[model samples]
Target: MRYLFSFIGLVYSSLIKLAVLFNPKARMMERGRWKVWGKLRGGIVPGGRHIWFHAASLGEFEQGRPMMERIRAEYPDYRIVLTFFSPSGYEVRKNYEGADVIVYLPADRISRVRKFLDLVQPEMAIFIKYDFWPCFLLELERRQIPTYLVSSIFRPTQLFFRWYGGAYKRLLHCFTHIFVQDEASRILLGKHGIDPVTVAGDTRFDRVISVYEARKSLPLVERFAATVPEDGLVIVGGSSWPPDEEILVRYFNRNPKVKLILAPHEIDKEHLLQIISHLRRPFIRLSEATESNIDRQDCLIVDSFGLLSSIYRYGQVAFIGGGFGKGIHNTPEAAVYGVPVIFGPRYEKFKEARELIAEGGAFTVSSAEEFTSLIERLISDKGYREAASRAAADYIRTHAGATERIVRQIIR
Candidate 1:
């Protein structure tokens, strides 16, 4: 199994080499790893206590952020070394101040992991949700490192739970502790004889709450939303893709009373033009809007990143995007702002999205008609809207404190 895993690792690296020619992300990743050693040598303090944190991508980083910040604040003696497996995460947060050293996670090969552990010499290593690498984890276990998997959830369909998964299941035993997101994950692990697991709700709830508390004050965005009359409603379309924009822009153009802040996931020229082509109402790009005339536009297209979560606070309703494609962008981000969140049908895999719906805090629509229908009801029925809004906020409040719980166990 070890030999097989190593061979697979070699093949993975070989594929990345071929992919680099065609994929910009692959090119960046390979380039990043090539320079990781230099970054580590310059950033890492010699003989210093370090806490290493790894996340697969941007979303996982958010899931682990609250805890990372907590560790940064509480354990001042230890420096944080954060690593990302993908360019989407590293490119966005390479300059993150929370981590003392930020770099790509060197490939999960045995030799690579050995060299990495030697240099970082971390007192503890933490892997964020669903990013378990066998070789890396096995090396950590062999070296007796205090490694943990936090905010993770396991399902029956995962490789570890399968009958032919003996080698894969060994990866679970490498963790010094496993902090899961739900009771089901814990029970599943227990059934597989992996004990000492705790159900730590989810760190995302805590992260979103903190985001709202310390949210950026986007003046122009606030003014754009403020332009809505007392009877009018403010709708925020967060991380909207073309499919989400079709529904949102269609609805926004037809209704004069509702103000839509279209914060698309992709702000490229092509996507922006696609959104603009569908808009009948006057809209202004956020970058173009200013204090002088920010109030005139009914639609504000967010042409930048890092503001979508904060923008949620200005809306009475939030339409999360990406559901029509891969999955939904952060639902907790909108729900934390105490608003009714609506998304498309690809939400079955997201636990928070499903729970939000079951609690009547969120609604999922499969088609444009359903989106128009439900959105209108949410806009017209004040009592129903408020009830859903309250439910969303309550869900966020209840699911919070998971960060403190996991930190208490690990930090001690």
Candidate 2:
């Protein structure tokens, strides 16, 4: 099984190398690891007491952020080592201040794992969400390292619970403890003999709440939000993809009175132009919006990153994107601001989205018609809108403290 896993890892590496010729992201993954071990040796002191945290991508990084910050505060002596499996996470957060050393996780092979383990000598290993490399887990267990999986969610369809999943199931046993996001995940793990599972909830709730409370004031957002007339509305379309934008563009066309803050997931020039071409209303890019006349535009197209969370403050209603594509982006980011939220129908995979919909804090739309109707109703009916807003905020408040719970257990 180990040999088979090693073969699979080699195949994966080869495929990435081939993909690099055409795919920029694949190129990044391959290029980011160039001389990685040398960089690791330079940054990480030998024999250092390191508390290592690994996240697959940006979303997982955010999920693990609260725990990283908490550990840094509580255990100042231990050096923090953060690793990312994807360039999407590593490239964005390579200079993150919370970790002492941030690097890309090398491919999972026995030799690579041994060299990494020998170099870092991590006191503890923490894996965020579901990026489990079998060889890495096995090596960590072999060295008697106390490894943990935090904010984990498990579904019955995962191979670990399957009849022919003996090899995969062994990986779960390597963890000293598993902190899951919900009771269903706990029960799933328990069925497979993975004991000591705790329903620690999702740490992202705590992180989003903190972001909301400490959100920076953006003058441009405030200016644009002010343009919303007394009876009009400001709708924030966050992390929007092309499909999500199409629906929003249709809605905006029908109701020019309502203002929109469109923040696309990717802001490359080509993509930006694509969004601009679809909009008939007068719009200005956030980068170009100034204090003097920013309020004159009917739409604000955000051309920058890192401001979407703060921009939610100006929205009376939020349409979180990515739902029409892979999954929904963060709903709690907007929900924390007491805004009624809406997303595409493909949000069942996101726990917060589902819970918010159940609580009447959010709604899901399958088509542009559904989206138009929902937004129009919410804007026209103040009582229903306010009820949704309250429910969204209350749901966030109740789900917070997951970080505190997980940190207490880690420190103990």
Candidate 3:
């Protein structure tokens, strides 16, 4: 089964390399891998005990970051290597400060895994969240390296829980410890006879709490706020998709005083044009405008990356996108800013969404009417807004330090 999975990984990697010729995102990943390899060749990690941290994408990167920082602090001699399975993670955080080398986890073929282990010579390996590549786990077991799965969340519907999941379930035994997100995950792993499980909760809660404490005032946002004095409410439509934009278009058109700052999931030219066409009010794209031009604009469409987290600081209410589609983007990213959050229904899978709603910091709407009505009321009622903000802030503070907890256990 491990060999079969390795062969599949080799084919997948080859396909991605070939697809890069036509796809820009794939090309970016290729370029990123080459850049990291360049740093490795320049003697980043010479002769030292090494630790490797693998994250599937950007979300898992956040979960791994606090632990990475702790390892750097605790073991000054041990080198750190960060590996990403997806381009979304590597592209955004290739220049990370904590890691000695940040590289793409090569295809899970035996030869590729051998090459990676030879290069890094990792004594300890940590896999974040739900990314479980069979060959990689098997290889780590064979090497006698202590492997851990941190902030893991397992559902009963997963392959490991099925009758045919015997081979897959054996993969769990490879790990020295599995630090799961909830009790349900702990129960499922124990049922498979993979004990030594700990419910560490989600590391995202810790990451968000840090972000909340570090929040600073943005001068540009303060200026924007002053310019739109007539606009009493600020509705930040963050990480919006086509469906989410459709919902917002109807609401934004009717309520003029409710100023908007929209940050779409994909900032392609066509998507930006689609948003402009849908909005009734005149708006300016942030990427195209000079500082002078934005002062007169009511709606500012952020067409760039890395600003959304800070932008949440300027908002009174935030509509996190992706709920109407496949899944929702990070709701806590906005919630940590202490603003009331609104999102479309279909968030039953997200534990944080359930926690937030119960705490009175979030409202999940099914349709345009519910969204618009909620926005109107949340804006007008200062008492409700304050209560929601308080709940959100309190929730973040209470659930922090999962990364610290995991690190302490590993070092023990």
lDDT of each residue in 1-412, candidate 2, tens digit only: 7777878888888998999999988899888878578778887887678988999999899999999988888888889889999988998899899998888899888888888888899999999998989888988998999999998989888888788988999999999999999999998888878989999899999899889879999977897898788988999999999999999988897797799999999999999999999888888998887887686788899998778989999999999998888999999999999999999989987888889999999999999988888887987899999999999999999998888898888777
Clashes of each: 0, 0, 0
Query: Which stretches in model 2 have alpha-carbon errors above 4 Å?
Result: none
Top model number, TM-score: 2
The TM-score between candidate 1 and the true structure equals 0.96
- Mark the regions of model 1 whose C-alpha exceeds 4 Å error after superposition: none
On residues 1-412, what C-alpha lDDT tens digit does candidate 1 reach at each position?
A: 6667767888898899899999989999999999999999998899999999999999999999999899889888989999999898999999999989999998778888888899999989999997778888888888898999999988999899899988888899999999999999999999999978999889999999999999999788887888797877998999888888888887888889899898888788988998898889888999898888687788999998888888899999999999999999999999998899999999988899999999999999999899888877887899999999999999999989999999999877
- Using lDDT as the measure, what is the rank order of every candidate, best first? 1, 2, 3
Model 1: lDDT equals 0.90
lDDT of each: 0.90, 0.90, 0.84
Q: Residue 395 of model 3: what lDDT?
A: 80
TM-score of 2: 0.97
Q: In model 3, where do residues sit more than 4 Å from their true spots?
A: 31-38, 228-231, 288-291
| lDDT of model 3 at position 355 | 88
Order of all candidates by TM-score, from best down to worst? 2, 1, 3
